[model samples]
Target: MDPLERLSSPAPEFLDRLAASTRALHWLVALPVLLLLLTGLTNFWPELKALHVGGARVFAWLHVLIGLGFAVALVPSVIAILMRRAARRDARELLAFGLDDYLWLQHRVLRAAGLRSVGPRVGKFNAGQKLNAVLSAAATAALMGTGVVLGVNYWSKDVFDVDLVGAVFRWHTVLSVLLLPLIAGHLYMALLNPGTRESLRGVTTGRVRRSWAERHHGAWADRVREERRAGEG
Candidate 1:
């Protein structure tokens, strides 16, 4: 088979499975986050609190329930990353930001504005994606931490400082609000941007057009191709 043909073919079989697993994990985490946000937002805006009868009570109960699910959903993914060597390796790469990523972001910004035709070769996750992942993870951690404080205040006695719990709630709300735009941008890129929409296949079908991978994630594609060749040999 020609190299170009290989370049446009479906990703390696293992990658498809990995993508599918991680995608499921991602949705597991994302769903509860969405639920918590919707329920929690009503509590944040006083006027909106009256939108539904007993809305305050409903939102409070739903928020805590959803927050529990959100925290629990994170555990399986963490366990998977720890148990799977490949996942750990990939996670490391994803977390490591370097000079190439900086260049990629610069090019990406210019390209997005229609000012440039090309940019640096991106890896599996582009710079923006990496940064978004980091920020989202941070937000999740903060929410989880503050959520525990809120949970304690609700279930237990006033052993801890009431003022401290209040402070935690404020930070939690602020972090939640900050994450909204980041999540929105991620969704828009994955679902709307023509150039990036195909990447969503990684999460959906655990496969994507080789051409899409080559064009958008050139560095990763090159690594994939090399690995394929090595395996064939």
Candidate 2:
């Protein structure tokens, strides 16, 4: 039997724990962004002028602190990703894809728009998830770049022109706005999608239905069964 096959078959408990951890991390990251956005709006919206400058300063400081917290969370997130990569490499299923996965993507999109007759069978992550991952990485990089520029502008206005800083700020705001919709979609999919909802349960309880594993990750499920059989043999 292939070593990859052995590794791909995650125990139900293991998959559950991993999903829960990932979701918790997501919420951890989102809370700070929400707070930062609220504080940011006070600075940007004149209608919010009732807010005192002192309060604004406090919010600004809080935003920076929260941003720092967000960065810190990346440490654990990076470690998890590395672990996942190792697991996938050993299992030969990192970003695993097949005809069913692609068909699932098409079906999901059609179903979303009320056009598909039947839903497609998805794998661990759907096409939308892959797209979200790419977008998130890009957004995080942009946010970091813009944040540095804005932070430095306070001391070296000449070196980092006020106009340039302003432009970066706009980009930062736009990116943040764009993320809002994506995040909402992600949440809905996780919480509302029947197939995905069970997978999400692993986040909180660290366990999923055996049936779910078989339906969504058939290949992975088979690998696990094979491993178990080999071990028994």
Candidate 3:
């Protein structure tokens, strides 16, 4: 089937699924990351820094506030998943990776470039998306840790020597720069790519069109079918 045809709603036999907690957490996490990027850019570029008086100082404090929000934002999703049985199951489905995911990555890249669909059956989270999630989580943790350290130095002089804090700041800055490409690619896939646009609804509404799920995540579609059949039986 043409991928575009599947953009519309699919039959009930096709599953529409994503945890409500997952949907909420995505937006929660996105806010601070975007704020950090915006403020960091102003501080990073001298010309931009010079454009507004006290902008750097103002954003520095704002970054700290958002940084704290970033840290807090991660906790509720994890807690909700662990506490809710359905969410726990969904988390497992998202985290599990096997042979199909590896093959999907190999072909999906080519398919995205206009080649034929020669990929293996993919799950709800494709290999690329899974990798993106893992990397993004790790980067967020690192940013939070480094940001805290930097914030400490800014407010108090006695916690650690200036040199140690400077080194940590450098690492934080480097990680922030490295994250740009991943963020850019994520935006392209989530917003710009026509084929994947429907997937965005999963985050916004806790479900995507069943057709898009099946077309992009065939293996996951199969699993959902099995679960539904088992439940009925």
Top TM-score: which candidate number?
3
Query: Could you tell me every candidate's TM-score relative to the true structure?
Result: 0.83, 0.67, 0.84
- Candidates 2 and 3 compared by lDDT, better number: 3
Tens-digit lDDT track for model 1 on 178-232?
9999888988988998777876777777777766677678888888888889999
In model 1, the Cα lDDT at residue 36 comes to 80
State the lDDT of candidate 3 residue by residue for 58-169, as single tens digits. Answer: 6677777777666766676568656877667666766777888788887867887988877777766888888787788788789888988887777788998889998998
Query: Candidate 2 local accuracy as lDDT?
Result: 0.62
Better of 1 and 2 by lDDT: 1
**Pairs clashing in candidate 3?**
none
lDDT of 2 by residue, 1-233 (tens): 13553467554334332444455555565666667667666666665535446544555666666666666666676467546543334223324566766777788778888894565554455556666766765776677567666655644577776678789989978887777677677778678876567756655665666666777666556666777789899
Model 2 quality (TM-score): 0.67
| Runs off by more than 4 Å, candidate 3 | 1-14, 47-56, 109-117
Which of 1 and 3 is the better model by TM-score? Answer: 3
lDDT of each: 0.75, 0.62, 0.76
